[model samples]
Target: MAIRLDDITTDITLEIDEDVISIADFQKATDSFLGLVKELSRAVSGNADAASWQVKVYKGSVGVGVSPLSSGLDSLRIRNVMVSGLRALADGIRPGEFTDKAIEHSKSLASLFRKSNVDPNVRIWSQREESVRVGRSVAAGAEKLLAAVYEEDGSVDGILEKVDGHGKLQLVIYDVLNNHAVKCEFANEQLPQALASFQQRVEVVGRVRYRRDGMPVSIRATRIINYPSKPDIPTLTQMRALLSGSAST
Candidate 1:
């Protein structure tokens, strides 16, 4: 008799699509699920001698809710069982494989969209119909506030150079505004004009650093990242290996 481990797995393909989110976000979500499944499968294999751990029994419907004969079969046990099913289906589908499929899918979608000649005029609807009396005035005020900072600093490049990549860049920008850079209370926020160059090139974040005087210095920086359009199974596997210290290279 076969056991049905989960009601979710049947007719439940991990619903992934290009429109809902970016390729990276989709892959991260999928890989997280896959990694957990892989771990469960590993545990199941490692516990082969444990009589209750039967992969085939879990696959059939009759044994579905029949708790594993093992002593400790509970939440973790059930998780492991479900993960085993996912792992078996995946058959070692790695991050790189998912990324490759995503890329191919995106290309196909883009081609279809182009062929359809879908008018993207809806994007401009807001521009034409927007009521700017209140919101626009507020925006203008904010622009004026930012104008002083931009003009005084010239460019935000000096601060941006210290940061490594895009993530850091975004973080820094948030840090600056969140910490009230307009007040200039933070020394790091008072960076030289060069850092402002990155304002146009990338997002600038203001962060605080300490000077030799035991005073906090505000620094504006952004992350420099070379993001790939799509990541495939091999790339993810290599990344995982590197992260896990198991990579041969």
Candidate 2:
């Protein structure tokens, strides 16, 4: 997402007077420089990956487990790096004032999450165009729940109204696990439980984030062993042939 600014027109440079040098004046100059750079970064080219960041889905399971990676430490690191850079630019500023500017810069970076539409401040997750387009097909499968909710009459309108109020879609995920026995033409395990688990795992209650192989991510029957609900017998047989030993039950 890097934007080349070589083609853009710009003519601006800041220089200080060679004479008068006071601690207060030096601090003022540093604050001015940092403020201007911050504003320019917001208005012109967006921040490099150096200033903005995101969380990646690490793992997921049903009644099993869910884990998220980084916990957003990467973004915090970026903020710290930016603050250090800002401090390096404050040559004659007092140490206290320089530290204050660093804190301010970090706060500015954190504020990017709330300004999803603005340049340099937008969040990768809250970008509506991308999510709506990419998640459209995947989200469609989850529509059954919405349809079920709609049967209550006010559910659809109410949900839409809530979304409008918050300006974000909401969702929830639930995991269900159970053991059952059944005979299938295609497989040995009962697939109704799998299907139920999938549908139950996906629910939209608020701003939703989607990730590949991430938590709340469900694997469908068609996705793994084909002809879901068919005898797991063939799959088991294939596994046994490949392993030449007992496989997980």
Candidate 3:
């Protein structure tokens, strides 16, 4: 890929086993690195096609450049997010710091350390940031978070449509915000509440687990607040008339 210095792009360096790399290694590294970046690009922008990028390679240390692909996505933001993810991974990113998708993607690129003839540690850095090294130590730190899925206090508003009474007593709520199913776990005491709100639009307040791409996967319900269904909700004319009466008073 051809890019200029003045372009709205960021240059990052990937130090490999050798300054002069073999074609096989180059292809392997290039495919892995670029594919990781594009995956992240899509994650950041939520546009798979817009993940396109213009990359440049520099001599010495297998330097790589990240530039916009005219897809209107912010390349600099993409580059910074990548750096943040790598650095966070090396330092052991918190559960809410990045989605599992991002971590898995990072793990893919970091797997370079496992390659033959590759150094025990793989180093990468952008022109404006310090180099981050990934290897066994980083992996050790990463596995801790990956093993225990990050759970955080959050809420989701959705329609409670599916309920499983046989097994663990799980409920599947169709998330209104992201248009996806969010598995919900509720206390036995909340069974009545869940049943009453079944097949209705409700807000599930509790812990939400979200994918890195902003899709919610599950939630542990502390409370379920049901919203009035469309038929029960006042129409525009009724709302306007009520407001008009209040104003007249």
Candidate 4:
């Protein structure tokens, strides 16, 4: 004899045997069970106005009813049975494994959110889109010269430098794509002029030396010249469209 669980509206019917249950059936049941937990939580949170819901379980069958009723006794009985089923399911699924995976995924997402300065409370779909945009922006910034070491005479364009307290003109050039920074030293003769163009795009011609850690320790600038400011980057919507192979707005 085989036990069966059925939900007519969802068109779900599955055999409930420990040895015979397929992976697909298990996944489907897990999803359905989690959804039910969410619905129950919402009801408990006062988001649901229904008077009652019903759940039934027997030796060989299970059923659910999400309708309203005037009385609460049936609802209480249904809740008890649902809890028992959830406990059994939890034991079968070894929920600790899923919990561990969920924790790891959350940590990764939190790290991404921190790097992108995006709020985690944003809509999940919007967060996904924003994460992709952030990744592309980082990639675009990294492909620039700032991320690489140029031991030879090389020119880096569109960087802003500032003067330090020691009266030396210093700046940290960042590779947004690679999440790295290169410290640069401006020629003493260029300090006066570089300070004048503070926070504005400037071109630096130099021989660069990198540390063993792959960060540029210094750029020995031979000359400095003002460069044009960069144009505004595309908006998230435009980036998304571009990434999706559509015309960017």
Candidate 5:
């Protein structure tokens, strides 16, 4: 089954520091804004395609709100995440500092402003009338600080919150270090296992991909090891006694 949300609305406001705005500059700013939000959405919800957008450009700034493109898109969650993540960035909060949400400090969430060539240090606004002015600076530094994604043999354990997509099957794993959900793809052979393990804690063993800051983003699962539910888990003493009995035998 799938889930869909409706009429969800929120705003992302961008303040450009320019005396005379040209068409090219405007496009760049909007592009950067969209790219920033796209990364934020993907980091938060595993999807970045906002539905419909309404651009309301005020005298001093441009505020953007979006509509759904199709069913099952949570544009609201995307916007909320944009707010929280921007707050973290604007306040100079580094990843793993106080709290690390799905949106990492260097999650490429602000990597577009550098291309914008417009000064965003003046102001950026969220749905709650809050301002985030670090868009440009964040974009600039991220290029130098954030690492590239690479694959390696490893394991990552998290709750199998969801499985999505039609042709391309993906599983969403909610990592505990942060509520960040990592989306992993499995072969058709592994689909049954992934589907059966939904909502359970499972460790995916295979080639894993990580973001620049060492966050797992992709896991090409060779196997899915479902951890025993709490009720099914034996106590430490019980396991030890069982092991002792086996040794004696």
Candidate 6:
């Protein structure tokens, strides 16, 4: 016989006599139940917002001769076990900070499972996305100011300097292609090397902070690569003056 639940259908059979249930029949039932759970997990995992989801079995039975026996029978005990396992998996997820859109999408996917005889639902696990110390990457050409964001494979050449009294490190890079200038910040550990390579071309890899006006304000560098050969790049002061002059005009 076959059991159909929503889009999942599996063939299952039960054999019973005046004696004990056959081991082969028990194995077949367990395998089918597990297969259904696997399918549900795959469908939910594809959604980026999914924190946790569950599969519930309300009623299940197996065909015995011309009749059916309830899943509670010793031979059919696997059904209850599988449902318990699914619940444990769903409850394990911890809800942290997440984007509003991501959370909404996750809820929507969970709602779909409510229409079936078995109720499978997804729960929002957490609102937290990433730690404060870590940085994330943002897309280019965004108008809104982005903080602690990095650009993949983004390289900058510039002069490095430390503020005399503030103990802050700064790097000014000029984008020749766009005819613009950018500035970034460095960690205290990176200050010594940047000072040694002062006024030299260097590559910076890190997250950036942008101004509300769509201009890059600064970068928090995670890695710094020095280039011995000076590229045809302008100094930080020169770029600043040039930008200032352009703004005034």
Winning candidate number (lDDT): 3
Q: What would the TM-score be for candidate 6 when compared with the true structure?
A: 0.27
> Which regions of candidate 3 fall more than 4 Å away from where they truly are?
1-10, 17-28, 95-97, 113-121, 148-249
lDDT order of candidates, best first? 3, 5, 4, 6, 1, 2
lDDT of 4 by residue, 1-249 (tens): 233223232211222323333455435444443354334433343335332333333243332223333343234433433334333232332222122122222223222333335332211111111111112232222233122444666656544634564766576554434323445677677768777777776666788776333455467778777755455567788788888999734
Give the runs in model 5 whose Cα sits over 4 Å from its true position: 1-122, 125-147, 236-249
Give the alpha carbon lDDT tens digit for every residue of 1-249 in model 3: 322233323555555544345576567567657776666666667665555666776643455665666666766666677666777777766434344545655665565535555444456565555556655555554565555255788888878898888877788888565446678998899888888888889888898886544556788888888898789887788789888885343
Error of 4 at 238 (Å): 24
Candidate 2 has its poorest 10 consecutive residues by lDDT at 153-162
Clashing pairs in 5: 4-72, 51-68, 51-69, 52-67
Q: Which runs in model 1 stand beyond 4 Å of their true positions? A: 1-19, 47-249
Q: Residue 172 of candidate 3: its Cα lDDT? A: 84
Q: Tens digits of per-residue lDDT for model 2 on 84-117? A: 3333333322222223323333234223223234
Higher-lDDT candidate of 1 and 4: 4
lDDT of 1 by residue, 52-153 (tens): 432222222221122234454343543434423323222322222122222222222222222234321110001111211111222222222223222212
Q: What is the lDDT of candidate 4?
A: 0.41
Candidate 4 TM-score versus the reference? 0.29
Q: Please list the C-alpha lDDT of all candidates, in the order they appear.
A: 0.29, 0.26, 0.65, 0.41, 0.59, 0.37
RMSD of each: 21.9, 21.6, 9.1, 21.4, 11.1, 21.9
Per-residue accuracy of model 5 over 161-181 as CA lDDT, tens digit each: 999868788898998676667
Model 1: weakest 10-residue lDDT segment is 120-129
**Runs in model 2 with CA error above 4 Å?**
1-12, 49-249
